[model samples]
Target chain A: MTIPVIAQLDELRSTVAAWRADGQRIALVPTMGALHQGHLDLVRRAGELAERVVVSVFVNPTQFAPTEDFGRYPRDLERDYAALSGTAVSALYAPTAQDMYGPNFSTKISLEGPALGLESITRPHFFAGVALVVTKLFNRCAPDVALFGEKDYQQLKVISRMTKDLDLPVEIIGVPTTREADGLALSSRNVYLSEEERAVAPRLHMALQDLAQVVSRGDPIAAAVAQAREALAAAGFDVDYVEVRDAETLEAVEAHDRPLRVLAAAKLGTTRLIDNIAVPRA
Target chain B: MTIPVIAQLDELRSTVAAWRADGQRIALVPTMGALHQGHLDLVRRAGELAERVVVSVFVNPTQFAPTEDFGRYPRDLERDYAALSGTAVSALYAPTAQDMYGPNFSTKISLEGPALGLESITRPHFFAGVALVVTKLFNRCAPDVALFGEKDYQQLKVISRMTKDLDLPVEIIGVPTTREADGLALSSRNVYLSEEERAVAPRLHMALQDLAQVVSRGDPIAAAVAQAREALAAAGFDVDYVEVRDAETLEAVEAHDRPLRVLAAAKLGTTRLIDNIAVPRA
Candidate 1:
């Protein structure tokens, strides 16, 4: 059965209120439509954690710079609905931009910690937009738990940090990144890749794996990063960054005294791809 | 009986959860704890709106600048407890600074519209600090509705705008400012007034009254504001600002096509006081 799509803010609240009245726990999976296997996996995991699950599909314009793909970001509500039809998802909250942000909307949420570098360096306004919209979703949905895919590792950390810092009473659970058989992480934006670019996309994940392995063996961090960047460049990718950092804080790591993460962001033709892997403690 | 003062985040959440489970609607009255009749009035109004009302007495340091009175801000928990003893207040959420903002608290909420000028022009860090801490309190308390006194008229407008802009679930209700018989707006900072300063303070409110009267009767706004400023200065106060603004947006008004407010801030000796009056339509 297809899940009900609530477009009105009042309707969403009433639906949540009704579910809450019945003592049902709720989980939220926030997305920007154009569903993929990864999003489906989030909905499924949301069901495991909650009796009622709400999936929000809002292509937040603020998260995208004017030069970025705000206009080109694929949005298919019907396809998203079809993707989650068989899942235990309770509702699909798809508020229009006007409903989400009305006239004279002048409030913004900015962060300084985990949202500092990574995607922010390339897309300066990215995390602030993410933080504001995610906060709005958390407030509107009033969920007990919210699921975010680890495919966007930096975003997951930023949201977790914002949730804790703001005292938002919701548990942020990061699901393991879903991947295709070829190992490229499943993403809605993956469709932007041309046929040739799609074939070469798996190399980003491969580079992260290689970087993680070398860092785990106590190899020089700079050398591991250089190798990843070189491999991406050889594969016709324009590398943005490849580095090893403390997993929790996303700060630069030299000794790996704590858990470490190897992250990479690079562009395959016009499509940007990012991937990360945990560096095992030596 | 005195209300329970919850200082821990988890305890506050559990308290809210228990109230929710009991099907109780909650209201919040946030203050800085030198509780006067104005704050008590907010708590009383909060009870009228919801079955349970949580009063948060936090002297939030973030809202004060280094040069401001953060270190000496009035905080009397025992006195505050006594003040709310016979009131309908359910819980007192007085989380410590360390609990409210942890070691790595890096998130901030900033506004552009209502928080642009007036008090913000003088205390640039003030509203941002208030915005962040209030957002945190709203998240932790999860109140169904929150009340703020109009004594801090700009702050009430700012919080109202923020709640709408951010889609925060709580409804913001503005309570009328409570005043002494002599008509000085009740404030925690009023405690800083000396005997001579206290006698002269009522003139600020009188100036706002006079400004509103002239503007309401079709006097030129600039002329009316100048008169109010001169009157404040003549009354031995250092005038900060005296102007008419759109009540809803807090923007300067050329024509009184909408509701208008006349506001003034002046310092008598070391004590800075602010007051506003509504301009009745002609």
Candidate 2:
């Protein structure tokens, strides 16, 4: 069955309220509208958790810096709707920029912990934008559960921390990253890559996995990360960051007595790619 | 009837959910638990708006700086409970600091617009702290409406802006400021004033009133505000600030073509007093 599309806030609220009155549990999957297999998987996982599912597709301009890809970011609403036609999504909430952020809008959610380091250094305002959008989504949907892909590992942890700290009633669930056969994590920005850049993108993930293996072998974290950075640079990538940090807190780790994650962000030409792998303690 | 006091989050949720099942709309009145007539007025107004009312008495520590009075803030839950006995309050949610903010708390709500000038200049982190606690309260209570006293005029505007910006489902209502016959705004901190300080506290309100009258007589806003500061200082008050601003946006106002508010903050002995009055357009 085709999913009903809701653009207005009042319409979305009425539909969700009716579903709620019928005693159906609701789940939310927030996206940026250029749906890939990764977002589809999140929708399917949301369906498994709740009787009703909502997929919100807003590009969220606040999350993008002026130098970032806010203007060039992919947007295909018709294509996204077609992709979700066969899915269990009950409604698609695709609010306009004006709808999401009104003229007088002026609130931001600042976060620490998982939001520190890595992406924040280059994109200082990124997580604050993400936090604010996710908060609006939660308040609008009032869902029982929300699903996020672990492809953006830091984002998953940041949202989890926000939901807990704010005592939001919804439960946050992170699904494993969906990857291509070549092992590249699926992202909407993948469309920004040229053919040659796309070929080098998979190496971003490959380098993180190599770093995780090195950490698992009890190599010193700083030395291992430097090695991985050199490897990526040699492979024609402008490495942004490659570090090993605590999996939960995202703080830099000295020794792997606790759970650790090897995360990396690199640019192949103009398109940036990020990926992470879990490093089991030795 | 005596109000049932609930401190645990789980108990409060279950009670509110039961009320929801019975089709009762809920209202929340958040306070610091000193239980003055001002807070009681909010509870009474909440009772008029919804079928059930909850007063959350948490002295949010984040709102206070190290130099401020978080440690010496009054704490008399027993007295607070006694005060609400005959009111329309259905439940008192008096959670401890640990209950309201866990160890992993890392989220903060930063606002612009209404949170820009006035109180923010002196108390830089004040509105962020207020936004965070109010967000937690809204999530925890899930009320249909929330009431706030307008004695903290900037706070009322900030909360209203946050609710609209974040799309929080709760309707934020501003209760009129409850004042003493001598015109001192009722506040939990009012008890900290010495008898001598209390006697001089009424001058803050009187000065703002004088400023408003001058503005009404077509006097330039800057000169009127300057005159009010001199008057407050001459009355033996350590003037912190006396300014005229746009009532809604809290931005500095040069003309009274729009609604203007004359707000003043001054120190009398060891206590600080704040007051404001509307400036009638000439």
Candidate 3:
């Protein structure tokens, strides 16, 4: 069945309102266009949770730094629609930049706890932008449940915290990270990688997996993380950060008694790749 | 009729949901619990606009600076309830601080534009706190319209902008400031005034009125504002800021052709007072 596409806010609301009037539960999956199997997986999960599903494809400008890939971030709406066809997604909310952020728009949502370190150090404005856009999406769709890929683990945690803090009525659900057969976490940015960089991209996940095993074996966290960074750098990746921290709080873990996660971000050529894995306790 | 005071979020939501289910529109008037005539005026206006009215009285801690009046801020729930007894308010949402802000709360809503100057210079965290609490109130109540007093003109603008920017599905209505017989804007903080300070408090509003008249007569804005500040200082008050700005944007008005607002904040002995009046443009 051909899925309906909603580009304007009024139309989106009317459609969602009709569904709501019929007592149909609505779920939303927000993404930046270049859709892949991972995004489709999120849509499928949203379908399981709600009777109606909406997917928002917006490459939010605020999340991208001036030097980062705002202009080059992959955008293919026609391909995205084609990819989403026959999926559980009933409508696509593809707002223009102006539609999302009109002139004189100047509000920002900032979060601390889980949004403190990791990606924020390099991209300080990233989560604020994500928070702002996600907030708009939630308000626009008024969804019963919102789905996010756990691939952006920190983002999932940040959105969960934001929803709870703001007392938003929507339930936030995190879907497990979908990965390539080669163990590379699927991301829209993965398309930016050259053939050689693509071959090397899976190493980030592999290094995180190795670090998780070492932490599970009761190795000193600092030493294990440092070793993982060195290995990634040796594999031609410009390592950004490699650390083991509390899975929920994202705070540095001093003891291995609590649930810990091994997280890493590295630049394989021009594309920055991030991945995380849970550490099994001894 | 006596307003039912709801202390729990679940109860508040159930009540609001029941109203919504009956096809009745809801209006919310968010306040801090030292209810004055101005707050009741907001409730009255809220009643005029919707079938049901909810007034949330939460003394949000995040909006207050450590050096500011959080500790000494007045809290008299019984007096507040007594004051609202005969008003049009249907329910009073009085959530405990812990209920509004849980242990892991780490989200903040910030705004630029209208939130840039005036009050923000002294109370930096003020608008963020207001935005956060108001967002929660809107979500919790699911109101069709939310009323705010124009006594805090900048705040009204900030919230209006935030509602637009965040795409919140609620109308923000700014009610005109309710004033004392002597023209002092009614505020909960007025209880902090001593007899001598109370006598001097009306001068803040008087000076703003004078400045508005001066600006209307085609007087240079900077000169008119400077003279108002001098008058406030000579009136035995510690002046914080007295300036003329664009009524909507809160930006300094370069020309008298646009809608102008004369805003002033001054400290009368230990009590802080703020007031604003619309300038008649030439």
Candidate 4:
């Protein structure tokens, strides 16, 4: 059976309101909707956490810069609905851009701290866009809990920080990143990669794993990241950044005294791939 | 019959959750609490709208600049509780500054549209602070409806714009300004006036009223505002602004083509007072 799609705000509210009135717990999984296995797993986890799950499939325009691929971003709603069929998911909230953001809509949620560096350095407008849309989803859906993939580690952290600071009643849970057997972090944009780029993709994760091992055995973080960047460049990728920072705060760390996360982003042709792994205690 | 004061977030949430479980509709009245007749009226109206009413008395530090009156902002909880005693208000959420905004708190909700010009011109940091704190309050209390005094006219419009733009589930209701016989809008800062300054305070309101009258009778908005500014300056107010704007958008208006508002802000001694009135459409 196909899951129901709610397109209007009032309809979505009434639906959630009815479920809430029945004393059912609601969980939300906000997605830009090119549902892959990773997203499916998030839905499964959401079902386990709550009685009903709302999967929001909005391709938020504000998060994408004009030069970015927002225009070509993959959208296949029928395919998505087919993928979610028979799953524990209850509804798909796919509000059109016009419906989601009316003509005069002008509020924005911005953050500091964890949102300051990393992805922000490349896409300064990205997290603000994510924060705004996620906030709107949270308010509209009124979920008891919301789930996100840790594949976009910084995005997860940013959302977590904003939710807590705003005192939003919902709990934000980050599910572990799902990856291909060869270890490429699953991403919607992966479809954009050519066969040659796809063949070279798994090296991004491999380099991080190798870097994590050396750092775990007490290699200096800076030098380890430098090596990772060089290795990715040698593998025919354009490296954006390779840096180790405090895992929790995402603040700059010169040494590995505390729990740390080594994050890296690189481009294989036009597709940017970002991945991070915890540095084992040295 | 002293009303209960809930200072901790956990306490506030549990109380609200219990009320929701009972299927009781909730309303909120957010105040900085030197509870004047204006705030009491908001609480009274909130009770008329919803079954249970929560009055949040947070003197949010972020809304005040260092040069402003944050330190001197009147806070008397016992008196506030005493004032709420006979009203329909159920609880006072007067969380401490530390509890409301922790050491690492770093998220803000800012806006354009209605939040531009007007109060934002003199108190540039003010509305951003108001937006953040109110968003936090709305999420924490999880109200079905929230009430504000129209005395802070620009603030009422700004909050209305934000609540709609962000898709916050709570309905924002504006209560008419509680006023003195001479038309001075009641505010917590009204107590800051000395005997002589008190005599000059109502001129701010009278000036807006006069401006509104002329603009409704076909005077050009610019000429009327300029005359109001001169009248206010002559009456011992170091004038901040006297302008006519679109009532809904708070955007500048030159002609009487739409619903108009006459707004003015001026300082009598150290007390900054602001007031507005409709332009009584031609």
lDDT of 2 by residue, A79-171 (tens): 999999989899999999998898878899999989998999999999999999999999998999999999999999999999999988999
Interface RMSD of each: 0.7, 0.7, 0.6, 0.7
Give TM per candidate: 0.98, 0.97, 0.97, 0.98
True contacts kept of 4: 0.86
Tens digit of lDDT per residue, candidate 4, span A1-282?
Answer: 668899999999999999999889999999999999999999999999999999999999999999999999999999999999988999999999998788778788899999988899899999999999999999999999999998998999899999999988889999989999999999999999999999999999999999988887878777888899999999999999887878888888877688888888999999999999888886
lDDT of 3 by residue, A1-282 (tens): 878888989999999999998989999999998999999999999999999999999999989889998988888899999999989999999999999999889899999999999999999999999999999999999999999998999999999999999988999999989999999999988878999999988888888889889899998888998899999999999988988889998988878889998888899877889988889767
Task: Tell me the whole-model lDDT of each prediction, alpha carbons only.
Answer: 0.91, 0.91, 0.91, 0.91
Clashes of each: 0, 0, 0, 0
TM-score of chain B of each: 0.98, 0.97, 0.97, 0.98
Docking class of 4: high
Model 1 interface root-mean-square deviation: 0.7
- Compose the digit string of candidate 1's lDDT tens values, residues B91-183: 998888988888888899999999988999899999999999999999888899999999889999999999998888889998988989999
Question: Candidate 4: misplaced stretches above 4 Å?
Answer: none
Q: Residues B1-282, candidate 4: write the lDDT tens digits.
A: 767889889999999999989989999999999998888899889989999999999899999988999999998888888889899998899898888888677698889998888888878989999999999999989999999888888999999999998888888898888899999999899999999999988888989888999999987777888899999999999998888888888888787889988888899989999888888867
Candidate 2 regions exceeding 4 Å error are B280-282
> What is the DockQ for all candidates, taken in turn?
0.88, 0.91, 0.91, 0.87
